[model samples]
Target: MTETLSIGERVAWYRRRRGVPQEVLAGLVGRTADWLSKVENGRIELDRLSVIKSLADALDVQLGDLLAEPSLLDWTPDTLGGTVPKLREALMDYQQMSPLLASDSTSRPPDLEILRTEVGSTWSAYQDARYARATRLTPGILAVAQHAVRAYEGEQQREAQALLAMAYQGAAMVLTKIGEADLAWMAADRGLAAAQESGNLVVTGSLFRSVAHCLLANGRPTAARDLVVASVGYLENDLADASPTYLSIYGTLFLVGAMAAARIEDRAMVNQFLAEAEQTAQRLGHDANHMWTAFGPTNVAIHRISTAMELGDVQIAVDQGPRVDTSTLPLERRVRHTLELARAYSAQNRTDEALALVLDAEELAPEQVRHHFISRHLVTVWVRQRHGKPSHLLVGVAQRLRVIG
Candidate 1:
């Protein structure tokens, strides 16, 4: 009956109500038991409306039943596989434990050097599209970083808090992508508070970027664009002497701003932000992942293609899709771009092209692409228009996405 149950949890609830075993239901739905398990645990997104309808038919219930939100879980600890619930517990646990530990001056904190490395690793997981796994790690990382902030001295304390801020931002980034906008906002707010305490401009801008991202996910790209436009000045400091880190974050913020403009179909703001992004990307000259922002010439070109898609210029997106070299992009970025290209192809009535891109993206990052809410929708739409049975290959992929029974 909860209003916020995630797609997976609702599926689980409906299945349980029907007294369906996971294996039996998987068989009925033409999906594997493992796939069903992942969906039930929230490892897979139940996004595509067609697939949800298919599930409703297979489970003998209304689609609305499976679409209901989950019962919110408290941190008092019943086991949870979903990331955000566990994150809530970790955040609450750290807030309580850090202050108590800080009261005792003699208690030794975690190693600062190690914590920094873990923060870097956490970012890697996020960039690789291991979103759920990243969420699972972030709260613990945040807790440790917070502990270090209280226990360390002077410069070390600042670095600890900054790393703590990064952890929160990482949580926000992953959560937003996974459709947890409210929780993403909470994590972003936490990051901003910690960044302010650390007095780091780079962290502050990065956290602002996270806040903007949460806004976009909540379907307010105009507000998101406004946020990026207003806060653009925050990163302007030290541009002349900007390190690769600064250039990367600066370019990424504009890239985000450009994306926001695209979502709301604000062509003028999109061009302006993209122009600014181009300047920053050109300054870098080549692809470089400074602070995991992955800002550079190639990334800028990719964003241009994405922008065109957002603007409903499908021809432009299709034209640009083949020209760009995708070899240099990260797995997650490449997969997302490929999927976006598929969307463009779909829009253009190029079913074969769209299907190819979807398959390629799925091959590259199955967990990311196949489990996305959009993936199912894409596959479902693709299937419905076929002259007859699709090729075996397409059906295999559709089956994996649970788009066909």
Candidate 2:
């Protein structure tokens, strides 16, 4: 329903739904009530995606919900240029390989232990923001895992199934970034099935999170929230005596739930989920990436900043972002947190700072930043809004990224 509206129409709709008076909303975000009124009435065009992003955050919706076009497919990597990369090709192969799917041998397969280590290495690449590298490993892992699942019995079979689930989950993550929601959903669907067979709570929760992530990218926040909410039951029985591994999984599911709530502007629900996640994080005491979940006190704080951004409190995002140290976290998390802060700065019309942060992201991870929609949006805004000569760096990035002529 909300997806059909124009950006301003969506803003007015969300703002009213949230029951924030124009004066109140404006004042909360450091803008004049008249400015907001004009924005809502179409007296002014909200040309900057960054500003619109801030407005949506203020309205407590996902940045896409207020977008002129909310479909992620509009700016998918394939749409950015003509061809999908090798990473996407690997994912395609995961679903396309024929012989691998048909092989049903019940004999001892390849080394399960060696396959498990390789799976861990792929996951490490994902954490480092080496998405292309990570995705490139997925197809091979998926093939190996399928063979292991058919041949190995007992504990080795269970381990193989777990690895297979993670491989699918990994495919889903990278596929989502490339804006292949349908493909990503397919991978997630396979992952959930494997998790059920493995009967591993942590793997089940993680796979559920992967599905939620795909749904979120596909603009089904309500469905995503419901999906994640149902998966929380996996952690309940063991949480009381949970190890750090269980705690991380426990907290991450809730955090992802909070994000889903944020997308729909359900402040109370978001807070409720975050509060539960906070308790779990507190028990864990410090930040650590267990099962690749990255759940703990610092991680929870990072999500708080993200929630604040989703809630449209740019000031809170700005304030909280710097306090969380990125050095200890994975590069993917750092890139995500930093990009949000860059959006917050752009919301305030701080173009130079936003540009600088955009550059920082590119420097931190070339793969993630290359052909990124946010970078393209930022470049377009800088071209439209900058006086005289823009920064050589900005022009260079925009030109190199083909964001501007």
TM-score of every prediction relative to native: 0.77, 0.78
Candidate closest to the true structure, highest lDDT: 1
Instruction: Give me the runs in candidate 2 sitting further than 4 Å from their true place.
Output: 1-108, 371-373
Candidate 2 lDDT, tens digit per residue, 1-405? 333244556678889899999998888767999998887765554644446756866777765556533222223342333223543565466443344655445545779789888888878877776665665677778888877777767877787788889888987887776556677888898888988888887898889899999887766778888987787875688777888988888888888888888867788988999899999988999899988887787778888888887778789888778788877888888887777778778877787898889889989876666534455555656665576988789888876655455
Q: Cα lDDT of all candidates, in order?
A: 0.75, 0.74
lDDT of 1 at 323: 82
Worst 10 residues of 2 by lDDT: 69-78
- Prediction 2 global C-alpha lDDT: 0.74
The collision pairs in model 2 are 57-311, 57-312, 58-312
